[model samples]
Target: MPFENICIFGAGALGGTIAAKLAASGNVDATISVVARGAHLDAIRRSGISLFEAGADKPLLANVTATNDPTELPPQDLIITGLKGHQLAPAAEGLAHLLKPSTRVVMILNGIPWWYFHRDESNHAELQFEELDPGGKLWRLIGPERVIGCVAIQGAEVSDPGQIRLSNKGRFILGEPSGDISADLREIEALLNRAEISVTLSERIRDDIWSKLMGNASFNPISALTRSRMSDLMADGATSDQIGKVMKEVKAVGEALGANVGISVEERLEQASQVGPIKTSMLQDLLAGKPLEITPLVGMIVALGRLTAVPTPVSETILALVSQLDRENCRTA
Candidate 1:
């Protein structure tokens, strides 16, 4: 499939950026959509999706069919969701409109997805992750088979309505949950690659996903809780030491769950230290007064530890702090 009809939910940052790039490419017979709400939707419908590269002020404009209601849109071959891991539940009912016979909803979120255990040989296989899935609504409403696994390495977010601040590379790792590379996935790979986004087809996407999680399990909450950027947290010897402790716990959980993450905690900590002064998505969400992704990024990992009979004292410590931040922020507001 060349994506003749495409609908990207949450035209916020990453989704809008990807929509703009797809429009720039002269392929796929092109009926592009950016599903958003409120001022963002109004602006995109009136003008267009404004895309910023490398968080620059000057943004590139691309004409996109932007709407808030999914029902009004045409049935699509693919529905790419750029929503945070927690927001999937609230939007599930609305998302049904985008589902057709062959539509695959690709989730671009950090942390372990709800469907992580589906079809795996591990004892945790088919076990629902309550942290990510909440009331089991997402796993039931959307169905695991319809979810194409995605891990976004690209850093981007909505600077404003109809505008997105994007990083240089997309580097989105894509894979089937069962670890099979299908022709459909190759088609998406071709489309995104043509748009200048570096796409990798993961044979063991779960490993790559959890590897990325090594950083998020440490930095995201630390950023949200401490209000520090990536460099500030990771570069300091003391913070790096704390991160190393967290990584060790995360690796134990991963191993107990049967996903062998082949990297030392020191290496992961050093890698984060070198990423410069980037702000995490959790920090960004906190700044914007939006709901934090505390559940999926941190809570789910700890939940995995419990499921697999692993200990996560460090992860639990951070998760408790971040959850308190979320609760206090919500309460005061």
Candidate 2:
């Protein structure tokens, strides 16, 4: 069955970009809507969503129903959540109105997801990460069965209230946590492809998560602490070596938990070097006076290291430093 009603909840930055792209595509046969708040919502309501891609002279505009309340929209066939890992738990209850029995929730999140252990046969199966999910609110309200794991390799930022700036053209990797190529997954892949968004179906989404985390866990915090770009960090010999150490530790923890990162530390560093001097999301958040994504990116790795009896000395040190930095920024802001 085709998705009839598609909603982009927490449409900010990457989410907003996805919504705008889908709306502008003119190929999707679904009713598109966005749930946003405050000035962004107002702007989207006033003029729809505008996307400014890199090197594009003019922005792409798309009109869609924009609302702050989930109840104002119909029950959706697909709910793509762009909320940060920390923000999901608090908003889970409010999002209930958008879900029916078969609604699929695609979480475009970084680090280890809350439903990482769901449907797994390992000792950690069904275990919840308090750092990400907190008091199991998401588990109780949203349920893992409705989740479709997604790893987004996109770079986007909200240039203004309702305007999105795309840094690069990136693709999304989607999969079922249970490792099944179900009907819903195929439908979503086709829908996104129709909208001209690159999509890849992965059989092992957890491994994809770890593959992305290899760079995120190391570079995000390092960038935050040093206030440097990817190129800057990769250019300096000492900083590059430090990033490699952190990646090694993160890879070790993932391996202990049966995730294959599938790349060497040098290869990962080379990839980062190719991205040039891009400001990591952590660094960008720090500059914007927003709360840093500490837990999912770094803290979760440290926690998992402990759970799997893997030593994360470098990750631990970086976590402590970046966490303190986040607290100090919050205190000042």
Candidate 3:
């Protein structure tokens, strides 16, 4: 059955755009709502969510119910979290009340998710990063079985409070942690496809997660540090060399976890360079004074390397620098 009540939690740039697309699809058969705060929430409540895709003259609109309080809302059949990795913790307690027994949570964020190591067969449960989730709050609250992995490859940002501008085109890869396809997964695929958004189901979601993380963990921090675009990062031999080294370390970490990324460093760099002068989400966040999503994008890779006895010196250095920069930004905020 199609999901009935849906909530797009953390209705920021990517979240708002996805919500708008699904709600405006006219075939989803779901009541779409969004949990957002501040001016964005007010704007969405007033005028719905606005999206301007590439090459669009005007904007696409989707009238979704917007709220800051999830407790007052009905239980959701599906909860799509669009928050950054660092923003998940504070919102977890509130979201716990919104989940019914059969509710599914699709986390569409970049980097290593909090549930990455939940059901691994290895004896590395002790290696779970407390920094990502202190006291395993999200894992215990939401339960890994209800969690679905999503690798979102699109670049989007909020031009204003209620406006989302999506640049380029990309696809979403969704899968269960156990590498099995289920009815709900197929339903999600159908919903996104109907909206004219690309979606795919993966047998091994972790491999795809690592595949995207390899690039995110490599380019995002370097872009923030250098204040450079993707083209600039790829053009400089030294900068691109650092990205390649970091990606190699990430590949080793993924392999140690039994998920091969299956792509060469050169190929990844070439593909990224072709994206032109696009600014990474990390760099955008830094410039906007928002909290840098360093933990999952960069820190988790470093932590996983430590667990697997692989060295990630390049990523580690980038993590330390970007983290300090984030701390300084927060200090003045």
Candidate 1: Cα lDDT at 250: 81
Sliding window of 10 residues with minimal summed lDDT for model 3: 120-129
Model 1 lDDT per residue over 270-299, tens place = 677677878888998888777788887788
Provide the lDDT at 148 for model 1: 84
Q: Each candidate's TM vs. the true structure? A: 0.94, 0.97, 0.96
Please, what are the lDDT tens digits per residue for candidate 2 over residues 2-60?
Answer: 68899999899878988998889879888999999989999999999989987687999
Task: List the candidate numbers ranked by lDDT, top first.
Answer: 2, 3, 1
Per-residue lDDT, model 1, residue 72, is 85
In candidate 3, which residue pairs get closer than 3 Å at backbone N, Cα or C atoms, i.e. clash?
none
Evaluate residue 97 in candidate 2 and report its C-alpha lDDT on the 0 to 100 scale.
81
Q: lDDT score, residue 176, model 1? A: 86
lDDT score for residue 190 of model 1? 85
lDDT string, candidate 3, 1-333, tens digits: 558899989999888988999899977888899999999999999999889998688999889999999997899999999999999888888789889999999998788888887666566643456888888888779887888899988888888889988887767889988777998899888877987889889988888989998899988999998889999999999989999999999999989988879898889988988888788998888888888999888888888898889999888889999999889987886
TM-score of 2: 0.97
Task: State the local distance difference test value for candidate 3.
Answer: 0.87
Angstrom error of the Cα, residue 62, model 2: value is 1.2
**Per-residue error (Å), model 1, residue 259:** 1.5
